[model samples]
Target: MDKVGETVLEIDLEALAHNYNYLKSKLLPKTKFLAVVKAFAYGSDMVAIAKKMESLGVDYFAVAYVREGVLLREAGIVTPILVLHPQPVNFEQLITYQLEPSLYSPKILVEFLKTAREKKLKNYPVHIKFNTGLNRLGFWETDVDYISKQLDNRDEIKITAILSHLAASEDPDEKEFSDTQIKIFKKISVALNERLGYSPFRHMLNTSGIINYPEAQFEMVRSGIGLYGYGNSAIEDKNLKPVAQLKTIISQIHKIEPGETVGYNRAFSSEGYRTTATLPLGHADGIGRQYGNGKGYVHIKGKKAPIIGNVCMDMIMVDVTEIDCVEGDEVLVFGQDNSADAFASSAQTISYEILTAISQRIKRIIR
Candidate 1:
């Protein structure tokens, strides 16, 4: 708890470990845990988060791209890395870095196979991604036979795992859709395994799925938000702890007269003489404009300082007329006192958007 500085993302490794163990406790005895460290570990420090997870004996690590996996490798992480949405163009880099790529299409499978062969690869590990319900990425269920056939012809590539993304695993109320997804995923697994004459590890659970559908836990579970301390489900959300807290310092204080405006667009007009504190954070740092114009607030000391006016690229103003604040007071953008969930509510968004939307350039202080 050092003095809060400008635009710093404080990561509590202890809290992260606590969250990891808590989620691990919920898993079945045979299920393995895979930490998703993609998007710079969800806009926190990836290298530090991955190292911490590795120390805790996480089964594997997943990233969104080949470069992300390469970053972990370059940092000396020996743990197996899964590239979730790898492209055909990066197959050579993936192979060269010994990173596993998630093959989601026939073209991707065929291209990666060629690259693997050219690199003299034998049983080169690759995960097959089936689009169960997300509809965002991965191959369709109808493409399962084609995928199996392609793998059958390509001996250079080893089918490491068959995985799918849950469309709504966090919302237990949406049990029907989640159950349907699980059923489809299981069917795909069975069909692929039968066709290939062997079974690869099957994983379909994200943070939400792991909590709501314990019965759906396959050989491995990929957790992205949960690892970062959010289950996004009512039941699971209660137990998990947040891993990041966006903290910044109050740079200046302004006392505006009645009718005066603040920030860009004159979005916030002072109703009366009021005090405002400008913090060293803005949309560029991931606090989007959606939080502007009294829509959001930052925690000053222990009180809520409502946001005022438009969010600039490098700064934002908060109405601190009532708070006993100063120029150098610590501002809690989103943390234990003012949870990301609370801040997101102000903008009619979710914790995921608030967390992942954070910019990468901000300084990360790991505790």
Candidate 2:
């Protein structure tokens, strides 16, 4: 716990395992689960998180880029890696590491096929991403026929799975929108299978999709946020548990008199005499500046301390006038008492953004 800095991110592998098993229980017997480890496992120590997930017999692992896949491969992760958004430039490295690429466009598919053939590979496993609604990256439904025609000519590449991203699976209120996405994905999958002459494993449901539409759990399910303990499931599913805890220590104390301005730009003024605790963390460590001026808080000695003034790059002040805390006292930035969910709510964001935005510079202490 005492290794590098005052501010550290505590990662509980036990909680992670609990969350993993909880999600596993929701899957059908024949369904496969792919753990999404992209963005450094939601910015909570990728190697450690992947190692823990791998040890728990995670069926598959997913990363957003080829470099992420390579990192896992270098870390001795032999699990099937699905590169969610791979580039053609990394084709050789991906192929060398036995990494599977998600072919989202005809250009990517053609380039990947060319690379596979040049490498003298056969039936190489690759996932086909269809753009049902997300419209981020994927082959459009209208482009399916063209893709199938190209695949027919190229015998080197094999379509291992057909997948898609759900746009509004998290919004329980948007039932019709979610339903439309699911239906479109299903239609695309059917058409793709018929055109390809073989039915590969089809997976469209991400964590939210798996939670909201269980019947749409084709052959596999990809879980990202849920595996780390935030379920997008429309209904309240008490199965998932949060795995990361952001903690810091009060490094110093300051007493401000009435009419005194605090921090840079004089963003916050003390109306009365108040004691403030200077925590050794700030915007540089994922505590955004938006949290300043009493908008955000931290738990000091189990009491809420409102953040004061403008957040600095490496430090932030919290009004702890009522709390009996001193220098070096542990402060809960986001955890048991103040969950990441709650913190996100206060910051006007979601848990995913909060988790993924945590900078890599912060010390990650794995438990």
Best by lDDT: 1
Tell me the whole-model lDDT of each prediction, alpha carbons only.
0.87, 0.86
For residues 1-367, write the lDDT of model 1, one tens digit per residue.
4696577889989989988998889888789999999888987889999999999999999999999999999999999999988888888888888998888888888888888888888988888989988898888888878887776766798898989988877675779998998899988888888898888998888888777788988899988888777778656667877889999998999999999999888999988999999988899888999999889998886888888999999999999988998888888888766778878989999987899889888888888
Point to the candidate with the largest TM-score.
1
Q: For all candidates, what are the clash counts?
A: 0, 0
Model 2 agreement with the true structure over 1-367: per-residue lDDT tens digits = 2333488889989989988887778789899889999999998988999999899988899999999999999999998999999999999999999999999987898899889889999999999998888889998888879988887767798898989888888787888887898889888878888898888898888888887788889888998888777775424435667789898898899999999989999999889999999988888888889888888888877888989899999999999999997888888888656778777777687788878888888888888
**Which residue window of length 10 is worst by lDDT in model 1?**
229-238
The per-residue C-alpha lDDT of model 1 at residue 157 equals 83
* Predicted structure 2: clash tally: 0
61 in model 1: Cα distance from truth in Å?
Answer: 0.6
